[model samples]
Target: MKKLLIIGFLSLFFAPLAQAQLGIKGGLNVAELTGREGESSSYKAFYHVGVFYQANIIGPLSIQPEVQYSLQGGNLKSAYTNYDSQLHYLTVPILAKLTVGPVFIEAGPQFGVLLNANQSGNLQVGFTEDGQPAYGNESRPATSNFKRGDFSVVGGVGLKLASNFSLGGRLVAGLNDINDAKNLTGINDPRLQNRVFQVYAAFQFGDGRR
Candidate 1:
């Protein structure tokens, strides 16, 4: 059953590419973690680059599929320590777009495969005799403690500035828990999920009707 499903999905995904416009996009990501309790989380700035295929299905409507390399994660701060979690993913989003004039709105489901995860920051070591805090820098591999896959929903709006150039903004809301650790500090659940806001620029080729 899974094999059949995979084959059908792949067929559906690729069928429109032959008639699609190809484009390249790069963007800034402001990402953070959600669903945890009692710990402060902040957005971490990152970037994504990718290519997409878009095909018009009917008047004012289109389907777009994209593959992107994205850097994501968040900053966590506690009373005595600060940590930055960097997670890397290869993400695919199949979006349905509706256009009116030069503006467009898009929504889609995104699938992500985790490539790597890392943690870096300052750790509170101890205190001086005078009660000043002392700290040390730390960095380590964090891949083992995170899930290998992520599912998300994306929604955005954009404007077509010219025949081949456009600018857009979007939000990616993760649907699953990414944390897989047995024991980890500063993470109390509902589990950790990714939340990201993105601003991007795109250039389309092949007749420019994207």
Candidate 2:
């Protein structure tokens, strides 16, 4: 009786750890920035590539961790200026996924570190009576006028095929303000926050399942 109890305890403790999965993934990111009051906003196209792993903790449920390179920010046009601000970040996300047969859905929070940034566009030089640029062809070289860190919320769904390949789409929106808008005049406060839509394909390794 004592030996049987010990065996049962060990099996229960190790069951979840034995079912973990890991995979390699890459994808496209359609990104933009929103929330600059009284200004017009537009989305930009970029690339997002990364890797992910899942640790199954219980029946049909798992914890997923991902690391990826992401492009963020957006284009804005106001009366005085029109430009695109590009930001690059190295980001990590911790997700909780619920798998049901061939389909799974996940949601989580992501943290990111800024890698680089730059701005290019046209800025008007004089007063506008007819909404025309008196002096155009303006540009700002690669600089760090924004913050160094970012945080976002992510959610997505996927379908598993042949226990090997999977296809999915995800939406990530920023929770913290990404723009510092430092020392620059005429730029609005709380100027920008990021938003992205991702479509990805991944292949599972090891046992051909995850």
Leading candidate by lDDT: 1
lDDT string, candidate 1, 89-151, tens digits: 999999999989899999999999999999899855556787776877888888987999999
Error of 1 at 45 (Å): 0.7
Q: Candidate 2 clashing pairs?
A: none
Each candidate's TM vs. the true structure? 0.83, 0.83
Candidate 1 minimal-lDDT segment of 10 residues:
181-190
Off by over 4 Å in 1: 1-19, 123-136, 184-190
Which parts of model 2 have CA positions greater than 4 angstroms off?
A: 1-15, 124-135, 186-188
